[model samples]
Target: MFKHLLPRMRERSAAANRPVSLSDMMEEFWREPFGNLSPLFRDAGYPAVDVSEADGVVTVKAELPGLDPKDVTISVENDALILRGEKRFEDEQKKDDYHRIERAYGSFSRVVPLPGKVKEAEAKARFEKGVLTVTLPRDAAEAVRNIPIEGA
Candidate 1:
């Protein structure tokens, strides 16, 4: 009796593993039946981040869609860099206008620890096209030192 549905189920299972489509599948996998699932449908608040270090600086890039510069905050202390922001859902829908909605909205925070100390006063942050880029200049003196070694 369930033989006909096997192929369709298999197709969906296969699609869930595709790199680009895996996120959607994961979201759907957690959805509950016949309940208020608005929160679940909202965007995964955490943004994707990338970090790179060169010479005496570390660069971090975070993807924050539909966010204003003032809404985001970046800070570093004791070798730790933190990113925090809130995503608000301001859209209002009429009783008979919408069928399905899937966009995350809420407060999100991400903290990253740097491998070395940075010059707090020299840190820089920029926001463009929904991406936040932060550049932290390392303390040059703290990054290197000559230790005298006596032959044993």
Candidate 2:
């Protein structure tokens, strides 16, 4: 039966460390965003994000439409860039005035692990035209830090 195959598919995906499927990816996009998964799933939610590093600077750009700049918060924790925000959908002033509102409303958090250390205090973030961009300059003294292998 199809029900039996669904669970088996999930088990295989977990074992292989790969995304379930394109159809399954769409399902996950509707259900919950994949913050725990790889960055390939960055475009899975209401506001998708794009991250890149260049010239000793790491930039993170997120699509946040219909949101005020003050409604969002950006912070750094343990060398990781954290973006947190909420979006709300309000239809009409009176409930009886409108039929319904199918817009999605909720809070989202994105934690991006930096490739190298960043100066949190010196970082700059700007929200222009619904796009949130955070620019982080790499640490000067320690431009490149070696990540240690565990149980290798």
Candidate 3:
């Protein structure tokens, strides 16, 4: 029954560098019931992250809707910033029947490479409106500067 979907998905996967995880496929299945409907974005095992390094600081922003700050963890590992979290889907009313569940929910872990060395202990993190922002101070000693040389 799903023969066409497999090949199409495979072709897409081959075209894109990032491999779609199983959770993403499951979410796609649950949300996209009809073939004609537009397929929702799938971010499996990782959230959409934007990382920028400028003015002696590194800033990372991640989109994690419907997730609490307490459930998230930020860490610096091997010169990379790591973000891990889980968005739990609660059944507030057991009597309610869901017609369409388009929101993707689950645990995710992602790593962003730093542009330069950062002061790990001085990092600041903030979560507001289901978005996570992490600010890291860059190490001054790691900054590159040209050294003057005398001709012999």
> Using Cα atoms with residue i matched to residue i, what is each candidate's TM-score against the true structure?
0.62, 0.62, 0.65
Clashes of 1: 4
As for lDDT, the candidate ahead, 1 or 3, is 3
- Residues 1-152 of candidate 1 have per-residue lDDT tens digits of 87676566657766765323444345556664433457645533377888899888999889998999988888887688889889897766555565776877889888887878899999999999999999999888787787999998
Q: Candidate 3 on 1-152: residue-level lDDT in tens?
A: 87557766766766784346564466567766454344543333368888887888899999888888889999998889999888888989999999999887888889888888899999999999978999999999999899999999
Order the candidate numbers by TM-score, best to worst.
3, 1, 2
lDDT of 2 by residue, 1-152 (tens): 57768777777777878767665566667786666577766556546777798998989898988899888989999988888888876555655665676666789887887877888888999999999999999888877669998995
lDDT of 2: 0.81
Candidate of highest TM-score: 3
* Residue-level error in angstroms, candidate 1, position 53: 1.0
Model 1: lDDT equals 0.79
Off by over 4 Å in 3: 1-45, 147-152
RMSD of each: 10.3, 8.4, 9.8
User: Candidate 1, 127: how far from true, in Å?
Assistant: 0.4
In candidate 3, where is summed lDDT lowest over 10 consecutive residues?
36-45
Q: What is the TM-score (0 to 1) of candidate 2?
A: 0.62
